[model samples]
Target: MTQIAEAVIDENGQIPLMEPLHVIGPHRALVTVLDEPPAGWDETLMAAEKALADDWLRPEEDEAWAHLQ
Candidate 1:
């Protein structure tokens, strides 16, 4: 199955929606849509690098991140 991320709103709060993927054949797969257009390649890469540098690397945070992975 293919997973698509989306934003959804309800009583509790906004939630992310995922679109299901269909398998057409043994070696083929298809997804209907994208949430948004892709961001600038260079800008996106720079932003990611900046974010990584800004966030302090602590032991507890590292452990939590590992759990997510």
Candidate 2:
């Protein structure tokens, strides 16, 4: 069986698991480090809002979604 989890690496090169592992005994695992920190809820919302800030106000865009309104 395979399992996945997220962890943060400490300054001393230690990774602390956010949750306890379900499997027991020795097992091989793969680790990948992201280039940038993961975005939280606020960051995601802000990015989406910024991307569509004036989209609805544009004439072409408004017409495209007119049928749904």
Candidate 3:
């Protein structure tokens, strides 16, 4: 299994879904992310913050969290 795909929550307080994604085409896909994932999501999020540092993601996308490389 892979780790979580990171995203930031929008002003609406919603994050982007990351997994179970299916691409219908270049412009469309389905994805999922747990607001509170089981086990170590908190730790994962923290680690992601450290990983991100001063980098900037697309704020318009509402990327409160970001997927770490």
Candidate 4:
């Protein structure tokens, strides 16, 4: 079976898979590393961070977690 998995290879060459794989048996795989980020990656990432912050930095969020604190 041929399948592809996504992962991040850390500075020390440690790889962490992005998601769970449901394969039953062990399979050998190859990893490819990119030396640079894709075009407009910074803009895309900033937009995503803003979108998350809009949802995360709300007054209701504080009320929701008031009990925990």
Best candidate (score: TM-score):
2
lDDT of 3 by residue, 1-69 (tens): 233455655579676654654445455333555566556668888988965764654573345554632
Task: Compute the lDDT of residue 54 as modeled in candidate 3.
Answer: 46
Candidate 2: tens digits of C-alpha lDDT, residues 1-69: 888898878789999898888877889989999876655746887889967877666889878998999
Report the C-alpha lDDT of model 4 over 1-69, residue by residue, as the tens digit: 777777767679798887877788777877788787645768999989988999989999989999999
Off by over 4 Å in 1: 1-39, 66-69
TM-score of 4: 0.45
Which rank order by TM-score, best down to worst? Answer: 2, 4, 3, 1
Candidates sorted on lDDT, descending: 2, 4, 3, 1
Q: What TM-score, over all chains together, does every model reach? A: 0.26, 0.52, 0.27, 0.45
Write model 1 residue lDDT over 1-69, tens digit each, in one string.
554444434358544344644557665433344455444646878879867866747676788789678
Candidate 4 or 3, higher TM-score: 4
Off by over 4 Å in 4: 38-69
lDDT of 3 at 34: 52
Candidates' lDDT values, in order? 0.57, 0.82, 0.58, 0.82
Model 1 per-residue lDDT at 39 = 44
Report the C-alpha displacement of residue 66, candidate 3, in angstroms: 19
Model 1 lowest lDDT segment of ten: 29-38
Name every residue pair that clashes in candidate 3.
6-67, 7-65, 8-63, 8-64, 8-65, 9-64, 18-32
Task: Please identify which of the two predictions, 1 or 4, would achieve the higher TM-score against the true structure.
Answer: 4
lDDT of 2: 0.82
Which candidate do you rate higher for lDDT, 1 or 2? 2
